[model samples]
Target chain A: MAFNTGAALMDALVLSVVSNESTYGYKITQDVRSVMDVSESSLYPVLRRLQKDGCLETYDREFAGRNRRYYSITEKGVDQLEDYRVQWREYAEKVDRVLFGGIDDDKN
Target chain B: MTKTEFLSRLAEELKGISAEEREEALNYYSEYLDEAGEENEEAAIEELGGPEKVARIIRANTAQSAQGAQPAAPKAAAEDPFGAAAQPVPPSSAYAQGGQSAQQAQSGPAYTQSGPDDTQSGPAYAQTAPGAPHIPYEGYEAPRRRSYLWLWIILGVICIPVIIGLLGAILGLIGGVIGMLASLIIGGATAAFAGFGLIIKSVFLFSSYPAGALFMMGGGFLTGGLGVLACAFGIWLIRKGVPFVASSIRSGWSYLKGKVRDLRWND
Candidate 1:
């Protein structure tokens, strides 16, 4: 894509992924990368940032006789996601207006 | 390389961070590799861009949390992150380890030797002390992301108020100077009017007392001349004042507009 996703967008995507179900680091990265061109190793810092900011929490879940760290969205993370959605909606609408200024049949 | 080699190198690269952070990072990476299973382990490692890059990312986060004054995580991160002091390590993540580097890693042994509670994965753990003091690096580039845009936005947001306050102060100062000049012009006019009145009085006194009339005339001319000079000076200042104030406001507005452009919101 020509456009680069900003930090807010990335944060929103990560939070959204975890919001659906508690998952592990590898899964989160894979899901996020499926949509955007993000580096595989990039999600760790984002996870750590959100974790410290109290947006996400991690816990150990046993799988195949090994512990896999699972991350679940917190209340703060949900609120942050909501905020991102609102802002993104507004942003997308504005961009659409500028790009499709002559699409006169559009209704709000 | 195998997951063990990747993780051991990563642990080595993250040698300076807090033990708590290091151990968590190791567990996370180790789990990541295991989750990939034997078949995709090489691909996973390759996707990670090797352990060096992963270690760099972890270290960068550690620095950021250290200086950011974040709770439970010591403060740090700018372009460079701070190395948080050794947080008390928890031994829980160390469970269910393979026969990886459980015995031969040097850094892990040093850490476990000092740690009252050590875990099983030797190579995965980085050396850290309980009270390890934070050493913040200056201007360390943040993680490889587009977050610098966000940082710039934040910085602009913080500086906006300060810039406005300074602009207000400068405008006020210019307004005060202009105000004083206006008053001076009025005062000069008043003095000139008084001097004219004195001169007319002197004319009236000329017939009755020549000496007194002469003295009054001399005083009137001196006062009139000083008043005119003051008036001229005030006018000159006012003439210069308009462009000076306008340019100041223009520059301030220009700077403010540039800042706003960078921080353009949807609203």
Candidate 2:
């Protein structure tokens, strides 16, 4: 589904993706693209923002004779992810209730 | 585009970002392309979109996070959230959005916003605030006006002597020519008159006329002295006229030299 992801949501998504395991930029972009129709270019800024906010950390590793940068989620990032989950649950339910009849109710 | 071309374009697009942040961003993107593999470079670039849009996202993200970090200091946050966190970013994005000239014009306001505290200080704030009538006090123009007066004085001093000298030289040249012509005419006439008187005196003496010879001799002597006196006066005119012309020329040259020296000193 196509959706305009807000900054908070983008940050949360990046943090959650990295929280799974430390991953390189291309892999993270591919993972995020599975759910959202965001340009790969848009992910870098979100990654930078999460890093700046202490929710992410980065390190360089060599693979195939070239340097590759990997991003990992920090404790702060996990905390931020928890907050985003709670907020997203409430927000999604509200948006779903308005768009559809009710998120869990039967529809005819 | 090739990886090199894409990275360079991205770097060019991110003009206002700090060196360290820009390096990090570039490193991230470079590694991203590398991870995409050589064969997928083109596809990766196409998926990322243009460098300009990417730069905008990065700049916006940096600005937003900076604001988030310091929520308490509203004043500093308002002054320049982007510049305070990252190195000052010039309004190059305006160029990316518009064109070169438009970006140049926008840079001024962007700088004013990101400039030193003096620009945001109380006095400047009051003067620039909307709906405030700007009234310059009496002393406001003092320094600049006084400098203008000094400039005029120096220019006048340098120019007046040259003007006067030029006028004098022109007048002196004309007067000297006229004086030389007049002196030539007067000297020739007196000399002719003296020669005639001498000839008459010689004729009277040869003819044995005592009284007439004496009268002619007296007239001849008197005419000879008058011719000599006229010649002397002409010589005097030549001497005085030449000096007057020379002095005027010398004065004009000295004034010109002085003007050159003053210009050099000012430089």
Candidate 3:
């Protein structure tokens, strides 16, 4: 509900996508939407940021009726994602262990 | 809210927000709407909480990221928290709307509450988040206000001659002496030449040149009035806000150009 959650969620979602091959803009937006709620406008800047930071590489690809830019994950992006995964695993494990011992094994 | 109104209002609220933020919020709402089966204004507003709140959340996260601080990541959220039965339904995670791998969803470091790169020697949070650059207002100085004293000075200068000319026409002899003295001091040797011309002509051709005499008298008065006008103008210029005439004119021209530009921009 806090403001940061929205952005954190977006970052999580974006990192989710870039972990694979490069993706274009519209597709990323769609992918984010498939799992959560988001607008095309919001996704645009995030994609731009990822590209700017060199975490992802973006190129244009024509889709539907227009050219949609796809963002592909970079080595740096992968490294970043791995670092996040490590942190996440630790946190999630802690939360799980606190709430329901050994239950963490069931969800993942 | 109908889809169009929702989109429009959302657009207006998101006006200055970064593109990434707008997209993220919209995507979140759209997914909520699709799943919740709610389309009314209240529902939309409730889901979004409040425009500013949503914006602030987005802004804070972005501001932090811009500052380069990220939080600890959690274990990857299950792709299908509801299990395989709901899997065919796309799990409807706003984020997973497109078929992306779990690894991709796990992408990027978990965001931290702290701002960007504070560990470095430089100032913490100095870096703006990617895509949103911080622009300082100091960089854009307001156009300087032009002084209006120049206008008053010019008007005053123009008025002096008219006043002196009227006085000269009223009391010819007395006005002639006053005009001669004023002109002598103000106009220097030129005033002496005109005075001598008046005197010589008056003696030589009093009756036959009465008309010429009157014309010469009018001419002398005009010259004296002009001298008065110049002195008045110089004094006005000194009293006015403008330090000098040239500067005033320059400011006036620039102000005029500025107004024109404003009109053009408005158009």
Candidate 4:
């Protein structure tokens, strides 16, 4: 029943992928599925939220026999993603430190 | 079965599901058709589940996903499919399942899919097709909502000088304390009497000449009053909303130009 795990992380990851170049919906969905456990339910909302916040822009491209929506990063989006990345990295490190204990001294 | 047929049936089956879920189910079924080959509806359907059983599973999964997303809704509200606040979940299979929050935090929450029926209550947005036509941001030109505090601050700023002037008048009535003390201490009876008389005369003059007294009280009151008025006017201008601000900003720019012209001419 606990569905919040890695949910926010997925949005951050999606932003990272879209930040690089224009990507279609299917590709983004597939990419998330390949690495981590992202429900299709989560991706749509994240995309909508990002668009609403002016972080990303979308256009349509012909794919297969139909037109598919393609998402691209905006300057605003890049800035937001950078902010998220900074926060996420710090958070990840802190989590790692606490969960694994002793800061994984091997990296040092 | 053809990909189109398979997708059509999947869509039909997932009618109560969110657009995201529906699209996902279609995509998944399409992928299955591609992988498992055509002429295998029975096999694919079997693999997924019988239509009724699949519907039940989809319902259960969607409910679970929705519950996962929105912890705030009541159990009755939770069960209401097509309620505008809950997420229209299809099944966990529609996406990678189970990455929900460990503890549902109140802030920075995700959007829960609400069905159409309850859309009026909560913030409801449709799962738009990726290439859906963009509805023009109609109110983009409209002004934003602002706090009423700015108006109050402007009014308070304007009142300061008036308050100071009133205090000054009260002191003038009380033998101009500084003048009375100085005259009595420095020059004894004669000076003190003169100072007291002068204070009485000033009070009488102020009582007779309200306008002159106010003017003598100086520009503080005027400045404060104008400041307050300007703030009130500013709030009024802003209250007309963003479109008003946009137009007024242009006018204000021209006013600035005219003021600059006046300043140059005066110089």
TM-score on alpha carbons, each prediction = 0.47, 0.45, 0.32, 0.34
Over A28-84, each residue of candidate 4 has an lDDT whose tens digit, in order, gives 766866765433334554565567558878886565565566789999888766766
The first chain of model 3 has a TM-score of 0.71
Q: Write the per-residue lDDT of candidate 2 for residues A1-79, one digit (tens) a residue.
A: 2122333555567788999899988999889877765567767766776777688998988888888878999998898
Clash count (model 2, backbone only): 0
Residues B1-267, model 1: lDDT tens digits? 998899899999888777988898888889989988999999888877777767765675566555542332222121111111122323333222432123223223321121212323221222222332232332133332236567777998999999899999979987888788988898888878888888999999999999999999989988887788889889988789778978998999999998877655311
Whole-model lDDT for model 3 versus the true structure?
0.49
Best candidate, TM-score: 1
Model 4's TM-score against the true structure: 0.34
lDDT at residue B66 of model 4 (Cα atoms)? 48
- Give a tens-digit lDDT track for model 2, residues B82-165: 221222225445325334334323222221121222121111111111222222221122344456669978999999989899
Ten consecutive residues with minimal summed lDDT in candidate 1 chain A?
A1-10
All candidates in order of TM-score, best leading: 1, 2, 4, 3
Q: What DockQ would candidate 4 receive versus the native complex? A: 0.03
What is the two-chain DockQ of model 2? Answer: 0.13
Task: Tell me the spans in candidate 3 whose CA falls farther than 4 Å from its real position.
Answer: A1-6, A37-41, A102-108, B1-267
Candidate 4: clashing residue pairs, number: 21
Comparing 1 and 3 by DockQ, which wins?
A: 1
Pairs with backbone N, CA or C atoms under 3 Å apart (clashes), candidate 2: none
DockQ of 1: 0.10
lDDT of each: 0.67, 0.62, 0.49, 0.49
Compared with the true structure, what per-residue lDDT tens digits does model 3 show for residues B82-181? 1111222224442442433331222221122222221111111112233333322221111111223455577779899898987778679656655655
| TM-score: model 1 vs. ground truth | 0.47
Alpha carbon lDDT at B215, candidate 3: 78
Task: Name the candidate, 1 or 2, with the larger DockQ value.
Answer: 2
